[model samples]
Target: MGAPAAAPFPWREVMEFGLGRLGWPPDVFWTASPHEIIAASEAFRTAPAGEAPARGVLDALMRDHPDDSGEAAEA
Candidate 1:
């Protein structure tokens, strides 16, 4: 038999994983949507060592456009 298929990452789990690395609380990270998680992850990945975006911008975009697919959000 071939190997079993890998499970997809759950939205909350992925968000928590990304946020945990940044020292955020579970409750805060879990409340974010998948798009938010993706955007946050990308931002962290692209940011310079001391140049992360403001939390307010991340929080606002996440709250205002929770349903965004992350394409428009990135632009």
Candidate 2:
């Protein structure tokens, strides 16, 4: 047989699994509003792998989510 069909990215399952590992209430995570989820995911993705802050990622995220005036507010 050729390469097996690639598995789909089970986003919900992955998010739940990660939250469970961190001792967070997985059910509560599932119930989060879309905006809240987006914000949280952006923060998580930008955070450094270790304790260090990922300033670059944070800056990029903020830059991307600028206000209607086309300028990002100071954090």
Candidate 3:
């Protein structure tokens, strides 16, 4: 078999767009980790009506995937 295909969704861009809809500024995105971005996207997907985007999920992701000198996090 060859290498795995890329994800169908453009996760980073999709995440960024979600954050934008949540009233977050662009600078917040530029400085955020992938974990934070993904978490925010997920939170948005599952949030109740009239609720704001959450950072609690982002905290969980950070604990699971820490920064490693520019290395990708392991599954």
Candidate 4:
């Protein structure tokens, strides 16, 4: 008999929680690796107090990958 396939990772919940904790929009989470999420979250925490939200990294990911928006290409 063939071995069972592994369950998919809980990407949605993990991403949502990570982005929420960092105070960044969750839109970038789907494309972010766990390491990236961790790094961004850590940076947010370690940033200077009263500084503007550090969303540049996460926001830039979306800006750079415009085609990954899940929209179908026009014929």
Candidate 5:
């Protein structure tokens, strides 16, 4: 018989983080492994909130991704 499912995977907290807080498109979220999602969420939580990004970093971001609207885009 198959081993039982991992308990942590069923936890709603992880699902919400992967789907909601991360704001990943549904397909991307679903495609990511649970460990991948958790690591990203943890990194996001530990990161400093509002501080100026370096000029080069900012410039590169704008050049690579030119979107006018979206909260995530700001950071």
Candidate 6:
């Protein structure tokens, strides 16, 4: 067989997450890269009952792995 067919892009689902679930403005949604959106979407959809990270964990993570925007995407 030739190479397996490529997976379809999940455009509608991604748009709904950005525009509806996350309530990002149209301009923000349109401008966000796929990686940025995926990171935000994952952060928002994680189980609410999960134990919260200790204070400053997020800051340390950002300092260590800053995004292209110079900060982590706000979920």
- Cα-based lDDT for every prediction: 0.72, 0.70, 0.71, 0.69, 0.78, 0.84
TM-score of each: 0.43, 0.38, 0.43, 0.35, 0.49, 0.59
Q: Whose lDDT is greatest here?
A: 6
Candidate 6: which stretches are off by over 4 Å? 47-75
Candidate RMSDs in order: 11.2, 8.2, 13.3, 13.0, 7.6, 8.3
| Model 5 Cα lDDT, one tens digit per residue, 1-75 | 999977664657766877788888889988998689878978988888887889998889886776765434544
Q: lDDT by residue for model 1 over 1-75, one digit each (tens)?
A: 999999885856675566667566877666777797778878878878776669998778777787767545543
* Total residue pair clashes for candidate 3: 0
Candidate 3 residue-wise lDDT, 1-75, digit = tens:
999988696866655575667667777766878788778778868878796546887667766678887576654
lDDT of 1: 0.72
The TM-score of predicted model 6 comes to: 0.59
Order of quality (lDDT): 6, 5, 1, 3, 2, 4
Model 2 C-alpha lDDT per residue in residues 11-53, reported as the tens digit of each score: 8665864476444586777677768766766777886667844
Q: How close is candidate 3 to the true structure, as a TM-score?
A: 0.43
Better of 1 and 2 by lDDT: 1
Model 4, span 28-61: residue lDDT tens: 7667777987787677678887865458865676
